[model samples]
Target: MLSTVRRLGVRGPAVVAIFLIGLFAIGCSGAALQGVGAPGATAAPGVATGDAARGPVEGDQNGSGNQPPAAPADPLIIKTGALSLQVTGLDAAVTAATQKVDGLGGYVSGSDRSGDGENASASITFRIPAARWDEALAALRGLADKVLTERSSTEDVTGQVVDLGARIKNLEATERALQAIMDRATEIKDVLSVQAELTKVRGQIEEMTAEKGHLVEQAAMSTLTVTFSLKPNPVRTEQQGFDPAAEAEQASASLVSVLQGVATAGIWFGIVWLPILLFFGIVAGVVLVVSRRFRRAGPGDDTPPVAPEAGSAA
Candidate 1:
């Protein structure tokens, strides 16, 4: 009977633990759905939502329905700009840009200078307060001799910020549920399982929290990249009288080159080509002499008396 009672005791707590986990799961899902469907359900801390989250009423005499949705009170915008300028001096332009950014409550993030003198150029990256983005750009432009190019862009991440806030909220609820379960857990296995789940939920919370913070920081600051290049130098021409001494030196050099070429030709003919030509000439002369002797013998010399026929001699 004691053994049977012990078995029942173990099974009772396990059943209760399973039932509680199921309840928590259902609750978390319902909360998540409600957060998604409800307007301004899980707004992040310090975010405004009064007019931004409200939609226009139907059949309003003020024609509110015909109007567009209201913009977010605290919109998250990532602003960036690029400017190319032709300046008289790289160092001076860079210095002026630095001062301008600082005066506008901004700071230089990075800077690079390459080449020198007429070919000098500089690229500077600045992080400016979003409120002062336009001011910083104008100030930097004023330091340039000419504006080569200018561009600006903005990105809205309000949706992502809101979504992260919702997820972090849901995860926190899950964590609380897990903590409650761990506190009520009587069996070692139940306790360990709850602890593991709690750790996972906390980790997710930290990650999402960090991501939201980064997005906020980016929206608060704007980035501007300014490139500075030296102004082009003007063309120049020089006029001067000819020099007799330089002409004389050039003429002497040409004459020496001609003499050297002639000498090289003479050496080649004597040492390399002359022997081959002489050998071929001697062979031709011998062949001609033999041919002439044969011709003279055949036409001019008397033919030897025809040998008498044997029968005529008898």
Candidate 2:
């Protein structure tokens, strides 16, 4: 009975005191408690902090804190030229053009020729530094007896170069992101997937890098193709008395020229078909001798001598 009464007193006093304290606290801070979550009320500390963290910052959306790089002062330009020239001697013109290119810190990239002497023509391609393109072109033109065709072209590649730069930057960024993902991957499937994406991105990056290098190279060097044609030299005639010595000299010179032409033609023929001709000639000679002997032989020699009549007595 004493334990029961003690428990009852303990429960009654605690309940009464909590009720009186709650009533007193409500009277003092009732407004603040009601307004805590009201629509027009100030947000709680946790909610305000969350909203502040999620809000956008003041700056450009591109996320780069710095400005873009400035464009180049000079546009990336590739220059090319084609020139046709008439000259007295194609060989001399080719030599002079090559020497000029060498003097200007350039090199001959290609050379081809057709015909000979008066009808000869040469095609020479030179790679000259862009800085000396004009000077080199002018010098090449000056080497000709007459300029038949001259053409020059300039291509601006600034847009392509700038595009490559931007693309490379974005790809590099993607590569970094992919690398991070790959590092964090745990499962085999996840690793394989990330590796494939990384490889693709890296391939694109390499291709664009190579393209940029090619563009830069083209811009640095200019191509010049010159065609050199040889024209016949003017002939001069001299008038003088008809002397016997002069006539004999002219006749001898004419004879020599004819003989030289014939010798040249024979030499070329032998060089081309001597073996085939000799084989055919040998076969023809053997056939001629055999035919002559057959004609001279008696009819019995042509007939195979009737096979000794089956076993005719010896």
Which stretches in model 2 have alpha-carbon errors above 4 Å? 1-69, 235-314
Candidates' RMSD to native: 12.0, 24.0
Per-residue accuracy of model 2 over 75-191 as CA lDDT, tens digit each = 889999999999887778899999999999999889888987578888999999999998998899899889999999999987666556545544554455456445555666667
Q: List clash counts for every candidate, in order.
A: 0, 0
Give the per-residue lDDT digits (tens) of candidate 1, residues 117-227.
798888999999999988887898899999999999999987767656666654554465456456666777666776777787787789878998998888898988999
Inter-residue clash pairs, candidate 1: none
Candidates in order, TM-scores: namely 0.59, 0.54
What count of clashes does model 1 give?
0
Q: Which stretches of candidate 1 lie over 4 Å from their true place?
A: 1-72, 240-314
lDDT of each: 0.69, 0.67
